[model samples]
Target chain A: MKYFRYKEEKIFRVLMLVSTLFIVLALAIIIFSILYKGLPMLSWEMISQTPKGGFYLGKEGGILNAIIGSFYLSVCSTLLALFVSLPLALFMNIYLKRYKFVLNTVRFFLDLLWGVPSIVYGAFGFIIMIHFGLRASLLAGIITVTLFIIPIMVRAMDEVFKTVPVGLYEASLSLGSTRSETAYRVFLRQCYPGIITAVLLAFGRGIGDAASVLFTTGFTDHIPVSLMQPTATLPLAIFFQLGAPIAEVQERAYAAAAILTFFILIISILARLSSGKFQRNKINF
Target chain B: MMLQNREIRRLRDRLNVSWMIVILAIVLFLPLLLGLGLFVQSGLLLKELSIWNVLFTSQWMPMSGKFGLLSFILSSLMVTVLSLLIACPVCLLTAIHLTQYAKRYVLNIMHPVIDILAGIPSVIYGVWGILAVVPLVSKYIAPLFGVQTSGYTLLAGAIVLAIMIIPFILNILIEVFRSIPTELTEASLALGATRWQTIKFVILRKGFPGIISALGLGISRAFGETIAVLMVVGNVAKIPTGIFQPGYPLPALIANNYGEMMSIPMYQSALMFSALVLFVIVMLFNLASRIAITKFETK
Candidate 1:
């Protein structure tokens, strides 16, 4: 009986071990697929050259235009979202909760937006952008992405703002500091690290997003000097280029995808690393 | 210096009230205002409003003027339901396994892996589905069904979405289970219940609401997802005849059709109407989940 129990336990443990290994294998497969398809043609010219009409597996295709457009859109949208979310979060922390029902309703909306599918947002953007007579322009894309980023920023900042002990606010109050003064100078200053994190997260979300960008950010092979013009993003470029019948276009898609993956990976790693550091520093200071 | 600081502080405090109000207004009201403004600006009500038929009809052809959201809505439901079916049970079991069965060392090792899974981009999951899963499905599963296949089916998309969302559900379940006072489990055992029975009666009950919320969120997440579905579901506009047949969901439809319909009012509104529909459904699901969490916490 004892021997049977031991053997049964061993089998179960092995099964669990194998399942965990499968998870690693799955992740490795994705990373390896991109690298295998992309790396052979990942030369300096491929990275630096301008976009061309005809596809080339070994030459001429570069993400320079896509990268510039993607970076511009992501940065602008993240900043816009931060600008929108920070004040609202600060307001919620400062004044809204005096009426609990109203505050809860506000939170309810924020949470709703947080879970909204990017596709639906894309639809909303389509309706409005078309109405504005904008045809897949960069401005349309940025504004669409801007709204998507806002809820994420607001939620993160709200939590960060809530953590600044009410006592701190009280102390500021007792010291004859006004609420606005304390909020802007003291509270905002204290939550600076978290706010920066919120911005980075928003940027990461914007840059990594493909669906929201598909319709609004009109795909152009050429880079735009103006935000009003349509431009291709890395994700959109990957989708359009890969979906083609041409093998060269497919190879370029893989390369663009690898680059996009690398950017997201870097951002994820940085966020994790910095948050860890912030936690340690918080304990110390 | 203290007097100067106090004066500045007083001035700042006086300035803050209106600023805070403005912030509140923007956060809570911006989307609603924008949506309403856009709706009015677009002249949706005065224009040819065929949204009702578009939403309910079976066919969606923008080029030919025949549009419907039936398949899109149904596909969205099917994908979400299938994903929840796979994800909910596995997540619940995984949570139980990690929280109750596994040793602390084993759990510590496993936790990071789950977190890493949660962190991976959905697009990466789609890529894996295209490369690894589709081939396997076509090679094995589709052959059984007597279908020639690429494996870019609804089943594959649902499975990938389920796998992507499982960690989220598991994480929430684990938190809920861990928070259950250990004494309740001990009491159940002390009262002569078996380990499984104790888990069923006590732990499961304790975690039920959290699990429900997790499932609701998972369903909502799966429902709204676009890129993964677009890539793997094959983007056929018709009602899917089989699991392997191409289908459209609201998100995929919007993504695929929105850009191409630059000049048409009906095309634009159909997409917006779809968006409005999806938004309302997601909002309801979110609200229910939040209420469930609050009710559970209060209990």
Candidate 2:
């Protein structure tokens, strides 16, 4: 019996090790397979110019249209989400700090919103577009994405707000500052790094999301001339290019995907680095 | 002058409060708005087909206005359940080991790795699915089973989804395991339990609710995921009879029918109805798991 128990223990331990190794191996394989297949074709021109004539046939022109469109879309959405969520976060943590029921209920709702899939947002955006007699354009995409990221940003900022010592709020209020002033100046001052991190994180999320914008942002080979015009995005660029029959187009699709991944990778690394770098600057209170 | 200054401050605070209320109201009501919008749009279909009819029928001929969704519903459930089956044990065991047994340095490295994995876009996961999993299914897994497939089988999708969701499920499990106070494990160990036995009896016993919550959230996430699954899952509108067969999930159906869905009558409404179904399902999964989470937190 002793030997059997020991054997069982050893076996399970091996199983755990193998499972963990499988995850690590899976990430490594995914990164390597994609990078190797696509990295060779990556170039400055590949990101610098819009698709020229017969672009899907693997002709001249880059994914510049997608790159710029994604930039505009995510940037606009992230900033919009920040403005919308900042007050919500501040209201919850600073203004209504003592109301546990209200706080919990709001947090729970936000969590629900966070769990909502992006595709539903796209569907809802479509409904709105139909109602407003609008077309799939950058404006529609940004509106949808802003709505999508608001919960995420609020939840992230709420986390930072919670970390704040109540003493800071108390001290600020005791100094004759209004609640709004304290909420804005004191919490904002302390949580700015975290707020910035959340914004960038949401931006990365918005940039990479294909499903939410799949319908709202109409496809175009040319760079968007206006928010009203249908615009290309990197995720959709990859989707459209990969769908083409030619191997060259498929290769560029891989390249576009690689570029998108590289953008996210840089963002995450920056998030990690900034969180650490900013830790020293944060006032402990 | 002091009274005037105080009065101005109070007025400013009042203005800020009202301004905030407007924004907060939007956040609070947005989900309801979305649900209402989707329902109203899908109401176009409900006007023609009963909800029960939509749920039960599987014909789905858009040309003739047949909008049966039974097959899509089943495929979504099948794929989500299968991916959960593939991902849960691995995530649970790995998280258990990392939190309970692994050295600290290993964890420091692993956390960021998990985050990066989670951060990879679903579209890229789709691309990788095409590059790696598709071929593997066709060449190796299918041959072993003596079946021929285009490599875009239900198994291919489940495999890709399992990998895509590993970090999501794993991250939550890690937090769950870590939150279980270490004293319980030490107490079990003092009673002459082996480390594995202690984990089995004490940690698992304590963390079971959390584990359920994590899996529930993971299911919700995997259930509604598009792009990746759509890219690989050979979007045939049929129930997959075998793991190697092609299937179309609801998210794939919603995503694929976008833009060009106008030429056919009831097609847009059908897709919108699927989104409504998806929204309600994801919401329920979230609601159930959140209750479990609250229970675990109280415990």
Worst 10 residues of 2 chain A by lDDT: A276-285
Local accuracy of candidate 1 as per-residue lDDT tens digits, B149-236: 8788888878778777777777777878887889999999899766666777899888888888878887778888877677787777
Show the lowest summed lDDT stretch of 10 residues, model 1 chain A. A276-285
Every model: Cα RMSD to truth: 3.6, 1.4
DockQ of each: 0.43, 0.80
Q: What is the lDDT of residue A28 in candidate 1?
A: 67
lDDT score for candidate 2 against the true structure? 0.90
Clashing pairs in 1: A178-B9, A178-B13, A179-B13
Residue range B22-126, candidate 2, lDDT tens digits: 987778898899999989888889999899999998988888888899999889888899999999999988998899889988798888789889889899999
DockQ of 1: 0.43
Scored against the true structure, residue B35 in model 2 reaches a CA lDDT of 95
Stretches of candidate 2 exceeding 4 Å from the true structure: none
Top candidate (TM-score): 2
Query: Candidate 2's error at A23, in angstroms?
Result: 1.6
In Å, residue A201's CA in model 1 sits off its true spot by 2.3
